[model samples]
Structure formats: structure tokens, C-alpha cells
Target: MNFNQKELVKSTVPILKTNGTDLTKYFYRRMFKDHPELKNIFNMSNQASGKQQHALAGAVLAYAEHIENPEVLINVLKSIGNKHVSLNISPEQYDIVGFHLISSIKEVLGDTATDDLIEAWTQAYNELAQIMISIEEGLYQSNLKKSGGWKGWRAFIIADIVEESSEVKSFYLKPKDQDLIGDYLPGQYLSVKLFVPELGHEQVRQYSLSSAFNPEYYRISVKKEQNNSNSPDGIVSNLLHGKDKGDEIWVSAPSGVFHTSFATDHPLVLISGGIGITPLLSMLETNKNSLQENPTVWVHSCRNEKVHAFKEHINVLNKDSQWLTTHVFYETLSEKENTSVKEGRIDLSELKDEVLIDNAKYYICGPEVFIKVQYNSLINLGVAQEDILYEEFGPQLLHFN
Candidate 1:
């Protein structure tokens, strides 16, 4: 944890950067072999896709790359903090991961892994783990300070359940004690933990808060992954789909960076694709009573009416709020619906031609491909990159650029 340790790790970062994937693969292989108990800790499906390995490797490389500027890695570490919390990744687990990571480096590097080199990586891993542990500890404290709060994860009774669509469902959760809850920022997400027998332990996934933050209960809208019935199915989403009223599920306090602050007079443009509408809807609801001068434009894209999650709710908000304007685009629709719902997705040309108003802050959240392509397009359309905010769903999707 010494400065020299970070410096040592920094010196060898280039080599680690080049072999990041190999290192991560080695790390995971050794981890699962030595501590097979961790098999339940990671998402096997993502590991199979090579996404998780690449993601962890990318982060370690970034840490080395930014060793001199650790402050710059705060956001990156914060995102990781959120993911770790959701995954139930504890401080103890960090030791497990760190132990094997160093071992992997020694095994892979062989003759190159001198005593000094090993010490450097050991210290670097400890430092990095400390940062994550501290951030996560702060998060735990924040959640615990609330009226109805607990550390780690706890079972919450399902106060109510509403069906949003054939594929999507909404769950209203309240602590078993039935006490008031702390308010969360609009556009934040909550991690629900489900104990899937097949998956073992518990698996976590993030779902955006569909309803405005209320002190009484939290609402999360989820789309069941029905795309592959032949597969085992989505761990959290599937578990949520079958549960009914009066059931119990574990809930974490809402946490995310994407938020709508009416404190600023800046104009706002909220864009979403598919079920990404959840967070935007929360933003609109939170701003419904605001008297801000700048307008808030919501442009949402979906396949059609059947799968669209919050059409009626959005329509009602549009009627009630004058500062809000709703623009709907359906990719595959009837000729009339296509004209009514502004056909296709939101792109650079579409923003330039249709979405007007400058000096506005843009907030986007959705699938990896959609958010990335649209975010880049917005920059191409002359929007300042600094003013744009986004939150990706999983740990693998890093938006450094």
C-alpha cells in the first residue's frame, strides 16, 4: 500500500496492459480452481462470453495507467463499488480476488516476476482493494443512516406487484418493519438479490427505479428475459416474474450516478431505447412540479406499443406538464403508427434535425450498443461530451471514452 508499491506496479503496467486478458483469464482460472467457492460469486454466462474477463482486465490496466492520477479513477472505482455491492462482493472477497490475482501474475510472468515486482503488484492490489472497500463502506453507511436501512442485503416484503407488460413487471418493496425510507435521486437504480437454486448463493442485477422516489416504498420495473426459453433463464428477472404479492425479496438501497437536478437552469434532453424508459420516466416525474425556465424533452425509442413499458404514464405526464414534451419512435410499426411514433432510433442526424435546443444537459441509459452509439452520435452532433451523462446496466460496459 506504499507509494513505492504503486510506482512499482506503474512501471510494469505496460506489460500488464498488453497481457491484460491473459492475466484475467489466468486469475479466474486459478481462482475457480483454488477457491471453487467463488464460482458462485461471478456471472458464469458473462465469463463464458469473455466479457467479464475483459472487463476486470481493463479495469486493472486502467488502474496501472492512471496510477499517477488515482483521483481520476474515482468515477471508475465508484461504478465498480456499485457493482460489487450489488454482487454481494464483500471486503473478504476482495482478499480472495487479490490473492489469486498476484499469484496469476507470478505464474504468468515467471522469471520476470522478481521479488520487487511481486511486492509492487501485491501493494498495488491492496491499495486498489482499499479504495473499493472504502467506497463501498461509505455506500453502506449512507444506506444504513436512512430510516429503514440495513447493512449488506436483507429480505424485504413485497408490498405490491403490478404487471407492466407481458414481458415486464413492476415490484413495490418495503422493509418488513414497514417504516419510512430515504429518498433517492431520480434516474437511479436498485440491485435486487435473488437466490436461484441452480445458480446457488444469490445473483444480482440492476433495474432502474420506475417511480419517483418516495419515502414509503421503492419501485423497480423489470423485463423478464424470455428471449431464450431453452436456457435456464435470467436469475433475478425470472425469480421476480414468478413471485406474487405478499412474497419477500432482498432489496438494496437505490444507488446510481445518473440523476436529474433541477437546481441548474440548464435545458434537459432525456433519450432512451426499449425498456430504458424506466429511468427517464422517473426523471420526468421528479421534475413534474418544477418551475425551471428550460424545457425537458423526452425522446424514447421502442419496437412497438405492445412492448413499450410506460406509454400511458408518459402520456398522462405530457398532458399535465407543459415544460415536458414526449417524442415516441417505433422501429417496427403500422404505417400510421410509424408516422405517429417517429420511426427508427435516435441518431446524430435525427438529433440535429428534430431535437432542438442548445446548452442542454443530455442523459442517456440503455443497452451497451445503443447507449454507446447514441452517445457518440450526440457528440458528433456538436453536443459537449462533458454535459452528457449515462449509466450502463452491467459491470462489463465501461464508458471511459
Candidate 2:
């Protein structure tokens, strides 16, 4: 962008900081109203809860803050790109988003939104959208070139289902065309696009692969999101729960940056709260199957054994593994459950220093607050920020200190 454009964009940083939320909330309302068809692709549940608005607000604020040096935000771009790829986001869709976004800004800013300022954001939006488009194109190409990969959404048949817990179940999905699927990195997620009869829309949702990479099939364990006070009930997850074996569902190729398959000699520490264990379980199984000498520890927190998915599976994996050990915390024990389990939230301090190797890399997943608390706790325990990693369930609300 030209100097005048960059200056104008930078000048809006303060305004963004103060009115980001209100602006994005308005943006979504305007976009959905003008383009209600997008409701099929966007998560209405998140939209209703204001989660997507919050995410867009943070993204815009960050963009305005670093408009002159967006290269510093490349990592953020990659994360967003990964998600876009999972949802089969096409480059053309950016035009729709950009148009609505620009309109939203003008509508929200009212008299203060000068033509030049609006023009600056228009250029800024296009530039950022191009970068995302390029990244997503590369991702799509890589996925298609893989042995068992296809672009966009592919039909998959549910071959089997395994009930993991009272709340979670694992669905084994195989390609209907009998094509090969690429070997995805552990901790990555696949987006499932299913037609929800109730919503009368095809909804897309990402579920972490719960098993090791398989060429013929993918295993995804889904937790039925029970509706309560904090949030609206899950639309897609509940739809998935009702799906029967042999039914077909459309799924995008795997995409994510939170995997641990990259070369790292450091010990591995996998921490999870509640159903966040899905992807971490894949990483654990991948590492174990690789037969590497890396020491691995699984620390999980859940309501209790009844709701704890993978309890038996984990025990079976732990039976003879010399390098693997598990520490579990249950909020309460069941009548028939054993007593060695501790009560309350996850307390990493309880583990010995040896278990948490000084140079061990930590991969944490869970709810937003749970992951944030664990991240800070790990930092306080002397774990370097670089050594700590997290997988957010949605647009990141937490900031690193």
C-alpha cells in the first residue's frame, strides 16, 4: 500500500481498540442480513454467542495495529489460513467478506469514516485477503497432490462407531470412492460438512482425529455438547451424534498447525481438560506408534471417569509402555471407581520435575479459560513460552503475556 494508505490504516488502530467489538458485531449482522446464504457455512451457534464477532474484532484490531508490518503477523495468518482450508474456503468468498466488512466499517463509523479512510481499509482488506487466498491455495494444492486427497469436500461413509464415554463417541469414516487419504499430522483436524435437517443448512464442523493416521479411514471422536447456561447447544455435533453407521457425510481434508509431528527431540508433555483430549490423543498415539525414545506424559482433567473418554483405551496403551505414564484428575470418583485418582482441576505441580522434563515441549488443549490457566501455570513453572503450545477450539480469545 502507499504511504498515505498505510498512515490512514495506522491512524485507525486506536479506534479499532475501542470499538472493535461493536464494529464486528455490526459487521456480522450486516453481512448475514445481506447474505443470509452464508449462514450455511458460518457457525450460527458461535455467531449467536458473539464468539465470531469477538474473533473478528481481535483480528481487525491486530491488523490496524500492525498495518505497516503485517509480516510479523504471518503466524496468525497461517493459523487462520489453516482453518480456512479446513472449511474449504475459496478465494472468491473473500470478496463477499471484504465487501460486507467495508460496508460495516462505514456504517459503524458514520461521519468519522472519511472516503480516504474507507479506501485505505479497502486496499488493506484486499491485501490481507490475497495473502490468505495464496496460503489456502497452497494448502489445497498440497492436499490434492497427496495419495488419498481431493480438493473441496469429499463424500465419506461411516463404517463404524465406538462409544468412548457417556458423552463422546468415535466415528470411523472411510472414503466412499475408495480413494487414498493423505497421512495427516497428529493434532490436525478434519472438517465435516453435514446436512442438518433441523437447521435446513449444511453445517461444517472440525473434529480432531482421535486415532493415528490411517490411509483407508479416519477416526473422529465427538463429544455431544450438552446445552447449559454458558453457551447455545451445538448444532453439528448433535447432528453427528444422531448419524447412523453406513450414512454418508462430506468432509474436507485435514488442516491445522498444532501437530507435534515436526522433528523435535524434546520430551513431550500432553495436557488436556475435558474433551480437549481428542487431538492430543492422536499426537500421543502417533508418537507411541513411531517408537521414538521420547518420554511422554498424559495429564488430563475431567468431571469423572464416567465422562472421561478414552479411559480404557489409555489404560491399554499404558499397560507395557516404559516411556508412557498417565496422571488423571477427576472432579469426583464414581461408586465403583478406584481411589488413586485425585479430585479437582489439573495440578501439574503434583507431577515430579523428571516427568516434566526441563526441555519438554508442552501441547495443551481444552476450553478457552482452561487452556489459558494451564498456559500461565506452565510459564510460572519455568516452561519457556516457546516450549508451550496450544490448540484453541475456536478463534483465539487468549493472548500470550
Candidate 3:
């Protein structure tokens, strides 16, 4: 971009910081009004909760803040690219989004929407879109090139459903054609698309592949997202829970920026809160036989034993390994429990020696608040920023300094 355009974008940073959410909300409303069919790809549930709006708002603000040195946003781009690839987002849609986004800027800012400012934002959005498109294109190509991978979506039959906990069920999916499935990174997730009867449209949601990467089958543990005080009933999850063994669902190739390569020699610290343990469980399972050189620790927090998903599986694995220490924190007591149980939220202070040590890789996932607490705790304990990684299921608003 030219100097004039860069200066124009810089001038709008303060406005975006203050009203980004409102602008994004308008953008979604206008875009949806014109392109209602897009609802099939976007999560309308997240839209209703304003989560999608807030997420885009945060992204725009971040982009505006780092417009001068866009390289700083590489991590952000990779994360979003993984998500886009999983959703099978098309490059043509970028034009649709850019149109409505700039329109929203004009409508929201009213008198302040000068032609110069609009032109600057248009150029900026185009550049950012290209960056995202390039990253997503590469991800799509890589996923398709894998041994058992394919582009778009493929049908998978639900071979079995294991009742993991009161709220979580593990669905074992095998390719409908009985062909080999792709080998995904341990911490990755798959975008599962289901036709919702009530919503009258197909809905897509990403579920972490709950078990270690297996070419024959993929397992995803889904917590029935019931209507809580904070949110409405989850459309796809409820539908999935009601499905029978022979039901077929469409699943995309596995894609996610968060994964355990076991590449680093750091002592692995896997922390999770509630249902967030799904992806980490896969990482743990994959690493159990291989983590001989690097000592590993699994820390989990949930409400109680009843909601705990994989006690038996974890216990079995724990008994088999000398280097793995498993700790479970339950907020309340249960009728029966294991010796590894504790009664409180996760506290890493006591385990400082294990977690705060140099080269310790920390992977955390959970509710927004829980993940944030764990992330800040690790940072506060003096862990290097790059050493800690966390994943959020919904729109990610969290960032580290």
C-alpha cells in the first residue's frame, strides 16, 4: 500500500478498536440478509451468540494494529487458515465478505466514511484476504495430498458410540467406503457437517478427533451442548447425540494448527478443563508409547467424576507408564473416585518444578475462562511465550503479549 493509504489505515485504528464489534455485527447482518445460503457453512449458533461477530471484530482490530508489519500476524493467519480449510471456504467468498465489510464500515461510521478512508480499507482488506487465501490454499493442497486424504467432504458411518460421561459421547466414524482415512496430527480436529432438521439447513462444527490418529477410523468426543443459562441448545451436537450407529455424517479432512509433533525435547505438560480434554486425550494417547525420552504430565479439571469422560482409559494408560503422572481436579466429591483425584480448580503453583522448567511444552484447552487462567498462570510462572499453546473451539479472542 502507498504511504497515504497506510496513514489512512493507521488513523482508523482507534475507531476500529472502539467500534469494531458493532461494525462486524452490521457486516454479518447485511451479508446474511443478502446471502442467506451461507448459513449452511457458518455456525448460526455462534452468530446468535454474537461470538462470530466478536471474533471478526477482534481480527480486524488486530490487523489494523499491525498493518505496518503484517508479518507479526503469521500465527494468527495460520490459525484462521486451518479453520477456513476445515470449513472448505472458497476464494470467491472473499469478494462477498470484502464487499459487505466495507459497506458496514461506511454505514457504521456515517459521516466519517471519507472516500480516502474507504479506499484505504479496501486495499488493506484485499491484501489481508490474499494472505489468508494463500495460506488456506496451501493447507487444502497439503491435506488433499496425504495418503488417505481428500478435498471437500466425505461420508463417514458412525460405527459406534461410547458413553464417555453424562454429557460427552464418543462417536467412532469410519469412511463409508471402508477406505483408509487420513492421518491427522494428534491435536487436530475435523469439521463434521450434519443436516439439522430443525434449522432447515446443513450445519458444520469442528470436533477434536478424540483418539490418537488412526487411519481406519476417527473418534470424536462430543459434549451434548444443552441449553445452559449462557447459551442456547447446540444444533449439531444435539442432532449428533440422537444419531444411531449406522448414521452417516459428512466429514472434512482433518485440519488444525494445534497439534503435538513431539518434536521438542521439553517435558510435556497437557492441561485441560472440562470437555476440553478431547484433543489433549489424542495427544496423550499418541505420546504414551513414544514419550520415553521426555517425561509427560496430564492435568485435567472438571466439575466432578460424573462428567469426567475418560477416567478408566486414563487410569489404564497411567498404570502402564512410569514417566506419566495424571492428576484430576474435581470441584466436588463423587460417590466413587480414584487416588489421582483432587478437589479444586487446577493450580500449577505446586507443580512449578514440572511445568515452569525450561523447554516444557504446555498445551491447554477448555472453556474460555479456564484456558485464559491456565495461559496467564503459565506466563506468570515465567514460561516462554512460545512454549505455551492453547486452543479455543469457538471464535478466539485470546492473545499473548
Q: What local lDDT does model 3 show for residue 100?
A: 98
Q: Candidate 1's residue-wise lDDT over 1-401, tens digit each?
A: 56776778888778877888888988898998888777655777677767888999889988888877878989878977876775567889888898899999999999999898898888778888999999999887887897665666667888898887667788898887676666777888777767778766656667888887777788988888764655656667778889988998777777777787634477778888888888877887777645553578888887777788877888887787778777887777776553557766765565575555777888887788888887888877888778888877666565644
My TM-score estimates for the predictions, one after another, are 0.91, 0.96, 0.97
lDDT of 2 at 95: 90
lDDT digits (tens) for residues 276-381 of candidate 3: 9999988888786454436778899899988999988988988988878888899997657665688888888877876665567899999999988998888889
Which stretches of candidate 1 lie above 4 Å from their native place? 1-8, 36-41, 228-232, 262-264, 289-294, 336-338, 353-356
Assess each prediction's global lDDT (C-alpha) against the native.
0.78, 0.87, 0.89
Clashes of each: 0, 2, 0
Model 2: per-residue Cα lDDT over 110-154, one tens digit each? 999999999999999999998889989999999988887778899
Q: Please report the TM-score between candidate 2 and the true structure.
A: 0.96
lDDT of candidate 3? 0.89
